[model samples]
Target: MAEIVNLRQARKQKARDEKLRVAEQNRALHGRSKAERQRDRLIADKAEKFVASHRLDPSGKDEQ
Candidate 1:
C-alpha cells in the first residue's frame, strides 16, 4: 500500500526544515551565549586601548 503525499504541504515542510538547518549553522558560527559575547567585547576594548596608547596625531588635524 502507498500513501499519497500532498505536494504543497510536502514542499512547505521541506522549506521549514531547510530554514531550521541554516539557522542552526549560523548559531554554531556565532558564539551562542552572553558570556561569549562579553568575552569578545572585553578583548576588543583592550585592543582598542592598546592602539590608542601607541597612536599619535596632530591636534589641529581634526579641526579642519
Candidate 2:
C-alpha cells in the first residue's frame, strides 16, 4: 500500500524548520550577554580616552 502525504503541509513544515534554523544562527551571531555588552563598552571607553590623551591640539601645542 502507498502512503498519502499532503504536499502543502510538508512544504510549510520545511519552511518553518528553515526559519527556526536561521533564527537560531542569528541569535548565536548577534546575541550578547549583559556582561559582554558592558565589557565592550568599557573597552571602547578606554580606547577613546587613550586616543584623546594622545591627540594634538589645533594650535600645535599638546593639550593637557
Candidate 3:
C-alpha cells in the first residue's frame, strides 16, 4: 500500500516550487545587460591572464 499525502500540502509545495523557478528565470533574463556581459568578459579575460602568468610549465611532450 502506498502512503497517503496531504493534498493541500502537496499543492502548496508545487506552487512554491513553480514560483521559485519562474523567479529564477526572470532574474536571469533581466539580470545582466550587454555592457555587463562585456565587462564580465573583460574581467574574466584579465583574471585568466593573471593566473596563467603564475602557472607552471606543462613539461610533458605530447603523445600525438
lDDT of 2 by residue, 1-64 (tens): 8899899999999999999999999999999999999999999999988887787763556656
For residue 43, model 2's alpha carbon misses the true position, in angstroms, by 0.7
User: What is the per-residue lDDT of model 1 for residues 1-64, given as tens digits with 9 covering 90 to 100?
Assistant: 8999999999999999999999999988974699888998999999988877776753324544
Q: Which candidate is the best by TM-score?
A: 2
For this target, which candidate reaches the highest lDDT against the unseen true structure?
2
Query: Candidate 1: deviation at residue 30, Å?
Result: 1.7
Q: How close is candidate 1 to the true structure, as a TM-score?
A: 0.62
Model 3 has an lDDT value of: 0.88
Clashing pairs in 2: none
Task: Quantify all predictions' global Cα lDDT against the true fold.
Answer: 0.85, 0.90, 0.88
Local error of candidate 1 at residue 43 (angstroms): 2.6
Clashes of each: 0, 0, 0
RMSD of 2: 4.0
Taking all chains together, each candidate's TM-score versus the true structure is 0.62, 0.68, 0.48
